[model samples]
Target chain A: MNSEQQNATLRKMAQLMRDGLKTQTEPFPETEKEFAAILEELRRLDPGDLEGKMVISGFVDHPYGPDRQRCMECMYYLVHRQWCDLPELAVPVEADWWCRLWRI
Target chain B: MANLLWLQGGACSGNTMSFLNAEEPSACDLVTDFGINVLWHPSLGLELGENLQKMLLALTSGQMPLDIFVFEGTVVNAPNGTGEWNRFAGRPMRDWVTDLCKVANFVVAVGDCATWGGIPATAPNPTESEGLQFLKRDHGGYLGKDFKSKAGLPVINIPGCPAHPDWITQIVVAVATGRGGELSLDEFQRPKTFFTSFTQTGCTRNMHFAYKVSATEFGQRKGCLFYDLGCRGPMTHSPCNRILWNRQSSKTRAGMPCMGCTEPEFPFFDLAPGTVFKTQTVMGVPKDMPTGVDKTGYIKLTAAAKAASPRWAEEDIFVV
Candidate 1:
C-alpha cells in the first residue's frame, strides 16, 4: 500500500488497541500446527475486518512475555515498512508490537 | 578397459534414471571415451536370466576383472535376515553385494539409498534395509566398518535423493581413469569435492537470508526460505547452488526449500506430520540453527539484520 494508506491503517490499529481491544494474547501458539490454525482463522475473516484479524492473531501494541519478544526481531516483520510480511497477516504493525504468530 | 557393473537392491531405479541423464560425461561417454566396459547394468545390460547369473558369477569367482562396482538402492536384509525378500539373478541381492564388494576394485554407492538407506531406512524400517556402510548416522551398516574395496578404500558414497547426474558420471569416470586412490573422502565416506559446501553457498536469496527477510510462502522471489519454509540449505552439505541442477537452477533458486537429502538422517523426523515444510521451532526459536551458529548468536544476528535490512529487501526485486 501507499505510505498515506499504510499510516492511516497504522493509526486505526493503534486506536483499537488503546481503546482496550482485549485481544486473545494468551495461549501463544507453541507449534506450527497451532500457528497455522490461527492463520486459518484470520483467512476466514472479511478482507476489511481489521479487528477480527488482530483478535485472532493475538496482536498487542507492546511487547509480551518475560523475553519481551516483539515484531522487530521476528523473521516476517519488515522493519522499513513497519509491516508483518506473513501472507496470512499482511498488516501494518509497530516494532514493539507482539503477536501469537511471532517467530525468529 | 575398466569393467563396470551396476546393480540395484531395494530401489526405485531413480538413480539409474538420473545416471542416464548425465550431461557433462554422459553415460554413453563412459563406454566410448572413458574406456569403461559396461559389463552389466539394470537398464542397459543385454544379459537376462541364466546369462545374467553367469556374468555375475564370473565377476565374483575371479574369472573376470571387476574394476568399478556402482550400487544403487539399499541392501535389503528382511524376512529373518535370510535376504529372501529381494532376490536377483538366482540368489539374494545382499549376498551378491557382499561378494561383489570383496572382488570389485572400487565400490561406488550412487544414491541416498545405497549411501545411508534413504527413505526405506526411516523409522519402523520393515524391509530391514541398510546402506552399504551406514545405517542413518551410525558407522556400520550391512557392511562392517572395516570393510574396504579391493583398492583398500571404504565405499565412496555419492548421496542425494537421486544423486546429481554429473556427480555420478564424474566420479565413475575418475575411478575408471585410475584417480580413485587420489579421491579424498569425508567422515561419511562422501567425496569432499562435492560435499564440502552447503546448498546455500551460491543461493540467490542469500541477501534476503542476511537481511532476515523470510519468504512466508513458496515460489516468492523475495525473502529466504529457511526462516519459515523449513529450508535446510544452510545446514545441508551439497553443491546444489554452486553446480546448479539442470545446469540452470537449483531447489533454492526455484524457491523450493532444500530438504537436506544429502545428509544420512534424510527424510528427517521420519516424514512426521507438520515437520516436512514447516520450520520446527521451540519457544519461537529455530530448533536447528545454521551450521556452527548458536541460539544466542542467532537471536542477536537476527535483531541486527532486521534493523539493517534495506527497504528493497522487502520488495519483489526479481521481476520477470
Candidate 2:
C-alpha cells in the first residue's frame, strides 16, 4: 500500500485495539488445520470488513501472551513495510503488536 | 569389457526410463565408449523365455563372469516371505538377486526402492518390499548388512524417487572404467560425490530463505518454499540444484517444494493428506528445521532475518 493509505489503515487498526475490540483471543490455533479454519473464516468475510478481519484474527496493539509473541518475529511480518504479509490477513501492523495468528 | 546385467524386482520401471534419458554418458555411450557389455537389461536385453533363464543360470554357475549387476526397485517378499508375488523365470526375483549378487563383481542399486525401500516400504507395507542392503532407515534388508559383492564392497546405492539420470549413468560408467574401488560411499551406501550435498545448496530461492520470506502459497516466485510449503531441500541431501534436472531447472527453481525424495523416509508422512505440500508446524514454528539448526536458533535467526529483510524481499524478486 502507499504510505498515506497504509498510515490511515494503521490508524484504523490501532483505534479498534484501543476501543477494546472483543476478539477471539483465548483459543490460539495450535495446528495447521485449526489455523486454516481461521483463514477460511477470514476469507468468507467481505473484503471491505477490515475491522471484522482484525477482530477474527485477534489483533492486539501490544505483544500478547507469556512469550510476548509479536508480529516483528512472525515469518509473514514485513518489517520494512510494517505490514502483515499473510494473504488472508493482509493488514498494517506495528512491530510490537500481535495476534493469535502470530507464527515464527 | 564389463558385463552389466540389469534386473527389476517390485519396480515401476521409473529408473529404467531415467537411465534411458541419461545425457552426460548416454545409455548407448556405455556400450560404444565405456566398453560396458550389455548382457541383459529389462528393456535392452534380446533374450527371452528359456534363453534368458539359461543366461541367468550361466552367470550364477560361474560360466559368464558378472561384472556389474544393477538392480532396480524393491525386492518383494510377500505371501509369507515366499517371494511368490514377484517371480523371475523359474524362481523368485529375490532368489535371482541373491544368486546374482554373490557372483557379480559389483552390485549397484538404482532408485529409492532399491536403495531404501522407497514408497513400497511406507507404513503398512503389505507388499513386504525391501531394499537391497537397507530398508527405510533400518540396516539389513533383503541383503544382510555384512553382505558384499565379489569385489568386497557393500551394495552401492543411487537413491531417488527415480535416481537422477546422470547419477545412474555416471556411476555405471565409473564402475565400468575400473574406478569401482576408488568410489566412496556414505553411511547409506550412496556415492559421497552426489548424496553428500543438500538440495538447498544452490537453490534459486535461497535469498528468500535468508530473508524469511515465505512463499505462503504455491507457484509464487517471491518467497522461500521451506516456511509454508513442505520444501525439504534444506534437510534432504541431493545435488538437485547443482546438477539441475533437465539441465535447466530444479523443483525449487520451478516453484515446487522439494519432497525430500532422496532421503530414506521418502513420501514422508506416508503420503498423508495436508502433510505433503504444507509445512508441518508446531505453535507457529517449523517442525523440521534446517540441518544442524535447533528451535531456539531458528527463532532467533527468523527474528534477525525478518528484521533485516529488504523491502524487495516482500515483493517479487525475480525479474523477467
Candidate 3:
C-alpha cells in the first residue's frame, strides 16, 4: 500500500481505540505460556480481520503504564515505516501506541 | 613420542567426528607434524579381540607410557553401579578410565559429555552417566574433585555438544608438544584461550544488538537473536563467532541461536517444551537478562534505545 493509505489505516485504528473501544485488555499475559496462548487466539483470526487482532492484543493508542511502554520500544515495532512487524499482528502502528504483545 | 589414548563411554561419538574433520592442524597433522602417537581410539584403533585387550593391559600395567588420555562421552556407571552395560576390552569402560586417568601425564575431557556429563546425565540419568571430573555444576564426578593427572592438572574440558574441531586438536597438540604447563584453564578446566569470550563477541549482529533491533524469526540476517529468540550468545562463554565454524560462520552468524553448550549446565531447561528456541520472558521482558543487566537498567535502556532508534534499523539493510 502507499504511504498515505498506510497512515490513514493507522489513524483510523487509533481513533477506533480512543472512542471507547472495549478490547480484551483485562488478561495481560504474565508468562510466555500465557503470552503464547494469546498469540494462538490471534492466529485463529482471519489475516484481513484487523479489528479482531487489535481487540485481542489489547490495543491502546498511547503508553499504558508508569514505564510508558509503547510500540516504539517493542521488539516487533518498525520505526522507519511506523508499523507492527509481528506476522500475527501486521498492523500500521504509531510509535506511541501500546499493546499487550509489547516486548523488549 | 607422545602416546595419546582415546576412549568412549555413554556417547554418540559426535566429538570424534568433529575431531576427524579438523582443518587447521587436522587429525592426520597431529600424527605427521605434532608427533602424537595414537596408541588406540574407538574408531581409528586397528586392534581387535585379544590384541586390543593386550594393548589396554600393557598401558595399565605401566609397560606403555600414556602421555595423554583423551576421553570423549560420559562415564556410565549404570545397572546399580556395576557399569556392565558399556564394556570395552572385556571390562567396564569406567574401569579403564579410572586406571588410565591415574597413569596418564595429562588427561583431557573432549566434549560436553566428558566435561560435564552432558545430556546423558541430564535427568533421571538411567545410564548413571557422569563426566570424568564434573557432574553439571558440581566438581566431584566419576573422578573426585581433587583428582589430577600426573601432570598436576585437572581434566582439561573442551565442551560443546561436539566441541569445535580446532579446540580438540589444538589442546591435544599443546599437551603433546611439551606446552602442557603453559596452557591456562578456567574454573571449569576449559582452556582459557577458547572459552574466555562470550559467543556474542565479534558477531555480525552486534550492531543490531547495540541498537536493540530484534530478529523475530530465524534466517533474518539483520537483527539480533537475543531479544525474543532464546539466544544465549550474550551470556554464554565461547569463541564461536571469533574462531568461526568451518572457518566461515557460527550458529548466530547463520541466524541460529547459540545453545550455550560450553557451559556446564547446558541443554538449559532440560529441553522442556517451548524452551529451546524461544526466549523465556516474564511480563514481556526477558526472564534471563544479559549476564549482569538488572531489570530497571534494562527497562531504562529499552526506553531510550527504542525512542532513539534510527529509521534505518526498521528497514531491510542486507539488500540483495
In model 3 chain A, the worst 10-residue window by lDDT is A22-31
Instruction: Please rank every candidate by TM-score, starting with the best.
Output: 1, 3, 2
**fnat, candidate 1?**
0.79
What's the TM-score of chain B for every model shown?
A: 0.99, 0.99, 0.97
lDDT of 2 at B233: 94
Task: State how far residue A58 of model 1 sits from its true place (Å).
Answer: 1.5
Name the better of 1 and 2 by TM-score.
1
DockQ of predicted candidate 2: 0.70
Worst 10 contiguous positions by lDDT, candidate 1 chain A: A28-37
Best by DockQ: 1
Top candidate, metric lDDT: 1
- DockQ scores for all predicted structures: 0.79, 0.70, 0.74
Q: In model 3, which residue pairs have backbone atoms overlapping below 3 Å?
A: B230-B279
For each candidate in turn, the TM-score is: 0.97, 0.96, 0.97
Model 3: which docking level applies? medium
Please list the residue runs of candidate 1 whose C-alpha ends up more than 4 Å from where it truly belongs after superposition. none
Between prediction 1 and prediction 3, which has the larger DockQ? Answer: 1
lDDT (10s digit) by residue, model 2, range B9-64: 98999999999999998999999999999999999999999999999999999999
